[model samples]
Target: MSFTTFLKSVPAFRSLATREVERLSSQCEPVAYPQGQQIIRKGDPGDAMYVIRRGEVKVPIVDEHGREKLVIRLGAGEFFGEMALLTGEPRNADVFAETEVECLVIRRKPLQDFLHKHTGVASFLTEILGRRLLEGDGIRTVGKYRLVGELGRGGMAHVFEGLHPQLNMAVAIKMLSHELVYDEEFASRFREEAKIMAGLKHENIVEVIDSEEAYATFFIIMEKVVGTVLSRMIDTRGVIPFDETRRILSQLASALDHAHTHGIIHRDIKPANVIIEESGRVKLMDFGIAKTQKEAEQEDEDIVGTAEYMSPEQALGRKMDGRADIYSLGILAYEMLTGRLPFDSPDPYEILRRHVRDEVPSPKLLNQRVPDDLAELVRRACAKKPEDRFQRCADIVKFLQQDAPAAIDLSKARAKVFTVIYDPEREEQVTGLFRRALAEARKIRGARISISDMNRIY
Candidate 1:
């Protein structure tokens, strides 16, 4: 049979126009795998979908304990990896050649482009995949966890409350958005997020229990915290009391310290990512754009963080470390104390520019009730230079543990001061000179400079 004829018989391509099918057939690359060879491995990034032309393959589902069970077998004309191709999710199962096999592989981009141009085929494929996710009773499940209710939705994924029938335990199931399934970057980040969270086991950090993929979509199972997000709490109560803020910041700091020690950096840290349980325990969640120390070093410079809470380095798209998280925590601390962000603007770029150029205003300036020492702590944490900020979250915790007035000497904390004398008459020239000097000084961690008007001083 002609390649186009065979493609027309495939369920996904059945609805496509003859020319569409011909276009897809022209893009298919045929390859063969010997019997006993592994065709696909679980957790590998999916790049293409395949249609069998000859022979057979066995699909094996592996359990948590590393045991594998043969789930299904496929023969000539059957297709596999369609879900991964459509969703950009990792392969969920291992496939082995049951016999010498020949497959016509359709690469991801062309197929996606084809689907984009043909909405009917895309919808048809979606309906077929959607049916595969539903059980006999009409309950939708990812692995063994059945989704019960939607907790929330974000740009990357939708969070659902789920229950495991066998385990009889409830969990928060985070499913990648279908709209983002074809976005390779988002898909990779979602998969890495699961791995990062699964490795971390801290009481103050939301625990990741498991991750699964069904019908080419990824789901992360996490412990459900019964509490409100810190953002909502701040919105409802305005300013949190100092004692409550201290407790929340301390717990959150410890969680961050733990993650940092493990070489993970939580790039997106904001009030919205924190949860305050009914018992007053703090649970830090969301590590979507996180990276390991090594990964950060190798990563291309891309600004990825919450604008208002971003560190100066992050705002400039520079490489960052755990200090970035400490800076964000400082912003969170400021919000908790003053009932407002240290920097706020309608335009995100303006906010990012402010993070890079302006000094964080003292929380005490906004709220008179803020203790001088505590306000100093927030200022240090949100310093324009990462080196000037608290080097570690553990240090933040230690500062919070001590009696603020006795533990911190305000004069010493502000001791590093540089005097820059510029002529007032040549204001434009002075401004340009100051910008150059400031840029150079920021390169040195913990370096401080104070500008003075030469006209006023002289």
Candidate 2:
């Protein structure tokens, strides 16, 4: 098939006017591949979306162990790289020629320009996107979580409200979107996120009960609650009451602090990631884009974060840390107190650009009702330079608890570490009122080594 003929058959281009299709065809660069040639590499920057004009190409599922299996094949009129091209993200999979193949590659800029002018083109792609392969039969079960109903769909996964068959306990099941299961890099990351969340146990962090790599999908079971996401509250109430905001901030800060201590940095921390339970408990959810201390992925054209809450380093694709999360928390705090972001503008990209170079306005300037001290805290927490922000997320909780009772000051309540010199002959099982505080002891050749830090490390 010729490039124009293939475009005509593509559902997205089918709706386009003859002139528009011609324009796209003129902008397309015809590319050819011999049988078994590698086309797209997973994790490489995607600059264009490709349409198959002749022959076939296969997307092989490659595992972390370096094994590969053929997952899907594309023929004439079919397209790939839509997600990468649309979001300007790295390629999520590897494509190889199944046979001698010919393709028409439309670069991102021209494709974006065309998409802007032809709105229905996006609608057509939406239809293709919504067609998840395994959803055809409707997945009814994954591991022990029996799916009751669909809770919601996120960018990369579909969440389901479910229950345990035996325990009869309520749970939320999150499954990686079927389409992404074939993209092993994404699938591995999806599983890794569950592992990270599983390691985190805190009152303010959502609990991960289980994670499984089922035959058809990867799913995670988590504790569920009947309540609303914080985003909805902010939407309905404009701004949260100052006292309520402080309480919520304390919980969120603690959650971030705990994760940081555990060597996890949640790259996304907008209100939508926070769930407010009926019991008034705050549960931070989703570590989908989080980076752990051991993650070796380099930064540079690999920016991945929500634009509104992105920190300066995140927006610029620079190295990030727990301080990046602090910046996001400040944005969340400012929004809760002022009912608006400090970097609001008509253009979204400009908002991101502002976070990189613009100064954060004092929250009090937006709402006089905001306390001056709180306003200053917000400004400092959101400074463009990470060093200017709160050095630790625990500091945010400490700042909020300044007026609380001395007992509520977590720093004062911090568990104490002690140096215990013990001889094998003298050791007769130690016990005291500090039993709970008596953390770990390392058994040496003839004695025990005292814990330098308590068991409650976080």
Candidate 3:
């Protein structure tokens, strides 16, 4: 098929203006493959989407027993790898040329250029995105908990410090945000994930005390860590002292290894997920996107991961295991030691592309104090190819322990408290001001506030 013909074949592309189409067609490359040639492998990084100009391609998957199954067949004008091309993720299924195949490859640059030239297409794209989002409620806060205070909020969920009044004890309840709950599929998967995590028991992993679906809300109860998150610790204290960072990371590695042994991969492993308690205990949390190796391969491709910490295979939408998590951990370790991410880009797709193609630079190159051995460790852990990376979480843990004398001190690191003093005269003035404000607020329906003494506010 000619490049122009192939462009017309795509629904989304057809919406583009003629001038935009001409711009892209100029950059398209015509390619051909013989029967039995692999166009894209499940684990390989994807640079562009392929449009079938001629012949046929077969999408193949392997069952648990390793038997090959042909899932879908594509013919002329059909396209595969659309998601991968947009997100810079890997192919989820292997595509093989079933017959002499001719294709027009619309690499990332040309498509991006075309889109830039056609802003009208952006609105059409937004409408498509809106339809996908409208499919579900996303995540919702369905139940009520004593709003003790904000414990933390990440990209996906909110953590709250709450009191289980009936039990007369304090516990942390993490509720999936309304946006996440709205997607019924994500919500259902999240509930199942909680169940799967509940079956896991380990000293390092934070225990999942209880989970319940109440009033159309999904909540997971967990033990609260009294200290700060690793991100904050790194920010406040600077790169953890080598010995201390190693110790804390070793604990993390041990905890991750335990999860992997049980077939759980913590797909997201940035510093924020690793919590350091006052007692020096390290706990891993947030398994919303984590999945077992077997489970991950069985589903449709999902590009739901933090770009900075995502493994190349994960970014590409390929089946992943513990190694993927290991890659993320390596990124965290590099950031902790150097105080900067290995790659930086304003666009997430660009960052993902870098992850897929760029080599992880040495940590020592950025921070002169970083030891050679530590730099080498980070490089190996962040290797673009899964096979070239650490074979397991345990392996990286072992290396960190032996290489770094100063490890992350979960015990020494504690959350800071800022105290403010209030004067009696100032308190009275504040009370008077608040009373007037409340009187006005009361006029507005659905207004609410808690009354407390001025001294208590301090």
Candidate 4:
């Protein structure tokens, strides 16, 4: 398989684009080992993880008396040594090749360095580690809901497919992890999201059915959706068709428009959180992490959302609004059209920096099939500054449907275009010309610009 294809084969790595997988592949060195060779020893320092290209490796359990017992067997495509990467701990178990093995080995320092920089990778790792740290067996129920099956888990919560005892309605129950429930601040945030979601009622969005703390566990129940998430669809299809992308975008924009009208900001709008029904209908999920207008104002260092889809303000940990969601939707729109994110890095921190400062290349540059108008819309939506982007979801819908009127060019209106000259003699004239140009531009826009610029146009 190709390098990118190999990475996508791993469930955790599927969300990453081909270019990102290529970059990661560069850090890995191919190595081989023969049968019975000890690859990792218990208590040894771990600074690297290896993905098996071929052969089998067995993790053995050893008693204090040095008796060995076979615990689990890992084969081609499986990874080992992540415990060290996640927790900085020594190897917990000894791994020996059960057969001749070839693997791609990525060293710890380089991997951790990359992980520290990329928010998406960090979020993925958190989910993986969270699962490992929590019960591997899993919880069967929470309060009134009897969990029929597990849906998914993240750093702070585990979701289960469940049903209410009295109502018998199908529901998805999200229980705050026991380890996190004790954190008053985190619990408050969780509760706040529940309350905010409870207030919203929209068909395009998942409905929050109920929330409560029972038997020391905090859980929220939402309408269960038996459909595939868009991210998984992207993984299987590589790139979504423009028509389908447009359809999904329209539905999602409608959902956001409704939520924004209700004063809620999704804060996270990646493909992973969008569900596509069997009938091709869209249902936006995971309001358990959305922020409200009131909550958005609180100053805190805590950051949320998958790093790849974060708006500039969200990545910077600054206060956010509905426009932040607009920016995130732009990123998703880009991915839907081009099959990749506009910005990527081995360091997620750089991704945040770029979101706040870099320009998003047009979608047509990556995919010839993307129409120029759609590409331009994506560019504007993903603009670095909130004021530079489409101000609302309604604007996006109107643009997509070709019903939008001649709209304001927010960038020129909000920006000062200075014409600098070397001649010191005409300073006053140049300054006067600048004032006249500014005045005319403002008059044409029908809005007063509270901007000040000394330089004038020629």
Candidate 5:
């Protein structure tokens, strides 16, 4: 078929007049990619859209863990990259030639000009794009659960707030990214995460309710935790009180101890993965990278976990055990008491380097109010050598409960709670006031101020 005829067959250009199609076809440059060559990579600048003229191409989604999954395969007359081209955004997926592929590439400037000259065609194309976006991996329901809203996204999956109509219960649904469902390895890993969580039952750990494959993807339903994430609490209320920090750390340690007993190591343990209930209960979550002790012994060597909280051995991709979790828990403890990470940098590698090599500064130096015994515990828990650190999570828990001293000056350690009542209309002004207040409070040594409540006066 002639290029002009082929262009007319494409859904996006079907509305164009014959003469307009011919003009657009004249601007299209034919290009060929050898088999296995990358045509477009994720995050690359999108300058043009491609229409497969002959042979086939495969679209793959690559996650942060360096795992790739085939998203779709496009044959002759099929199109890709239009969304990125129209929105001027980076390519969202990688495209590679399945065979010796010939494609008609339409550059941005000419396409924009052509669309401007054909308003009706532009409208039709917009409608098609909207439909494609809505139909592409945008699942609204899974099995008996109806997903209501997105809670958050991690490296491997997107978590949604879901509801069951029959039970009238709310649940958190962790859906493996639609792009990753096709890869057996990723799917199995996701199932393994669910299996691990389901097997371990503890008060401090978030419980897995069910796991299902629906809408061609895998999702794990978990008990919906209604509370604030620990990270948000740390951000809003800097330098948590010694009592609260000890309680939180103790609960986390107990949870880790249970998992470790079962031969599971929660490879990722950070404040963001912990939710604090109003009743002072801590629920640990997101076992996306959790591995068994046996799995750790194998030479997989995939360094995973947040850089800021990574243990020394984890940063080096060395074999880890329950002691690794203790190390991470120690980092969390340092952040909780000091209101800052022991090692932080814009570059992740630098942070990892510090975790592996640098000696952690004493927590007492960062926050003078930190009890001497607690500071010593933090230092020992974060020891560079695994053997030097707390051998078990229970040891840390016991130390926090029995050995850690109470604050010498309770008056200085206690945070003054303030409740601000304001008209709902003055929210912006009140928010600005709070920001200024926080900024000023940070300047004062050992001074910590946080807005505990905001009540609206009708």
Candidate 6:
């Protein structure tokens, strides 16, 4: 099929006048692919949404067993991946060529520009989006806890803000959504493990106030936290101060240590699971799939956990202990210190491969401000071999509290390493720029050069 034919089928372009279509067509490049090629993969930052002009493609989601489940197939004129234009979240599914295919790929930036330039076009798309949002089958939960509002939603469940009426307190409830409950194994496992969570009592762990099977839905009521999540805090303020980060980690390590003593392993530990409460306290939550020492994978071969935060063993589907949680914590620390994950890849399989086989770059590699001692701590925490990591949660707690060895060299880890040397050319350049800036400053009459400026010049 020709690009022209493809444009006619696209809803976004269908109503465009011939002249407008021609204008848009000139901006797009015609691209083709062979059969079985992957157009996109899960965890990839969606850059563009494509319009299928010819052939077909299959959209597959990663199932619990690390296998692919074909969710839908797209043919000529059909569009998918519209979400790419809005949220920068990773693509949720993988798109593969079912046969040799051709597509009109429209990048987000260009499409955004086109919409803005054409007010009528923009309004039409907005109306379409507003209608879709209104028609969305968002889960409607009965307010056992007075529903304040929604917190957030993921593939597993929709978190909500609610008030415990009798208790007269605010709390967040992670109610298992209908779709999530559809997976009998997941639902059963969640209910079974929830019983163990009831026994968990620790300051650092989010208190599981209540667990109930209400309205045919399994729900876990947890303490409501009002402060920023670790993930968001890191994004807004890159690489927290060493002292602050250490304090937070120390608290979490203590919590994990307590949980471990009770024979419970938090198999999934990530930034999202670790909440920084309003009063500057840290609390770990989400034990829905956590494995207890006495428990087994009870017939449910489905994989559960975030790919970005999974430990090497968890990624390989091996039986994991508390060490898995330690590894995840290490990854979180690495991310917090350096504004990026230890590894990156569009393919989940590829990402897992790197986790198992690749060497993670030291935190100092990306951010020079990272102390060598802190980087070493992160390295030990993320070591591929569980034995190589801080063997006990107590050890991590000690390290964070300044009680561990101080052998790490922070100077080498800093980004810009400069030797104390005299260089005439460099000195002159620096002095020239400084003197010029100083003269301009003096012209303002309200400013004066400091003694430090004379020392720098001399």
Top candidate (TM-score): 1
lDDT tens readout by residue for model 6, 1-458: 55655576677666556555665565566569799999898889987777777899998766789786546788988766666765445787788899999887767777666654543333223323322333433223334675667687665665767678788898877767533454566678778656766788888888777766653357777777777788888888777766557768888889899888898888778787787877879988788778776553332245567777778888887767788888888888888878789887788778888888887789998888776677988899889998899988988987765643244465653332223344666888777766676545543322223524333444
In model 1, which regions exceed 4 Å deviation? 1-137, 404-458
Tell me the spans in candidate 6 whose CA falls farther than 4 Å from its real position: 1-144, 296-302, 403-458
Looking at model 3, residue 201 earns an lDDT score of 83
> Which tens-of-lDDT digit does each residue in 1-458 have in candidate 5?
89999988877777567876787687789999999999998889878888899999998766778687546899998888876544566887889999999999978767666654543334334334333533637435667887777777654576778897788899988877533554556667889999999999999999999998754457899999999999999999889877678789999999999999999999899999999999999999988789999998765566878999999889988888999888888889899988999998999999999999999888888888887767877888899999999999999888887854444586556656556777789889988988888756754544435566536345
Ranking by TM-score: 1, 5, 2, 4, 6, 3
What TM-score against the true fold does each predicted structure earn?
A: 0.63, 0.60, 0.56, 0.57, 0.62, 0.56
**Global CA lDDT computed for model 2:** 0.76
Q: Is candidate 2 or candidate 5 better by lDDT?
A: 5
In model 1, pairs of residues that clash are 87-181
Poorly placed runs, candidate 3 (over 4 Å): 1-149, 165-167, 298-300, 404-458
| C-alpha positional error of residue 116 in candidate 6 after TM-score superposition, expressed in Å | 46
Question: Tens-digit lDDT track for model 2 on 1-458?
Answer: 55566687887667556665666677789999999999999999978878888899998776777688548889988878765543466887899999999888878777666655543333334333333222543335666666777687755777777888888998988877544654556678888999999999999999999987663457899988678899999999886766668778889999999999999999899999998988878999999889886562357586777889999888888777899999999999999988887887787789899998888888888788776657877888898898999999889888888844233455544343555555445444434423434321211111222444233322
Judging by lDDT, tell me the better candidate of 3 and 5.
5
Estimate, for each residue in 114-153, the C-alpha lDDT of model 1 and write its tens digit: 6545433343344345444443534367788887766876
Who is ahead in lDDT, 1 or 2? 1
Which 10-residue window of candidate 1 scores lowest in summed lDDT? 118-127
Winner by TM-score between candidate 3 and candidate 2: 2
Stretches of model 2 off by over 4 angstroms after superposition:
1-139, 405-458
Supply the global lDDT for candidate 3: 0.72
lDDT of 4 at 180: 52
Q: What are the Cα lDDT values of the candidates?
A: 0.81, 0.76, 0.72, 0.76, 0.81, 0.71
Model 4 TM-score relative to the real fold? 0.57
